[model samples]
Target: MKRDSCQQRIYAVRRVGLAIDRAARATSKIDKRQAARWATAWGVACGVRQF
Candidate 1:
């Protein structure tokens, strides 16, 4: 597979993962936006890349 196409697939997967995380947080009675912020901060602190 081409590098560009592989990158696009990785990006799409990250977006979907983030969406699922937010949805799960919402169902748990947490504020979605706040949950997203927390997730991003945690990712950054853990040296993980964010999309």
Candidate 2:
């Protein structure tokens, strides 16, 4: 029973870790997309076509 509990704890920790990794990846993707949009807007404002 103790071993099973320990295994459960490990599984929970792994799930939490995976969730954090997924969140970080999602946030990074959003940040990258926002940066791209901002760059495009700035380029347009400056009349530059070489992005």
After superposition, which runs of candidate 2 have C-alpha atoms over 4 Å from their true positions?
1-3, 27-51
Score each candidate by Cα lDDT: 0.61, 0.53
lDDT score of residue 42 within candidate 2: 45
Q: Could you give candidate 1's per-residue lDDT for residues 1-51 as a string of tens digits?
A: 555855765665566567557757595556776667666665554346555
TM-score of candidate 1 to 2 decimals? 0.46
- Expressed as tens digits, the lDDT of each residue in 16-37 for candidate 2 is 4554455556557776565555
| lDDT of model number 1 | 0.61
- In candidate 1, residue 44 scores what lDDT? 51
Winning model by lDDT: 1
Clash pairs of candidate 1? none
Let me know the TM-score candidate 2 reaches against the reference structure.
0.46
Global local distance difference test of model 2: 0.53
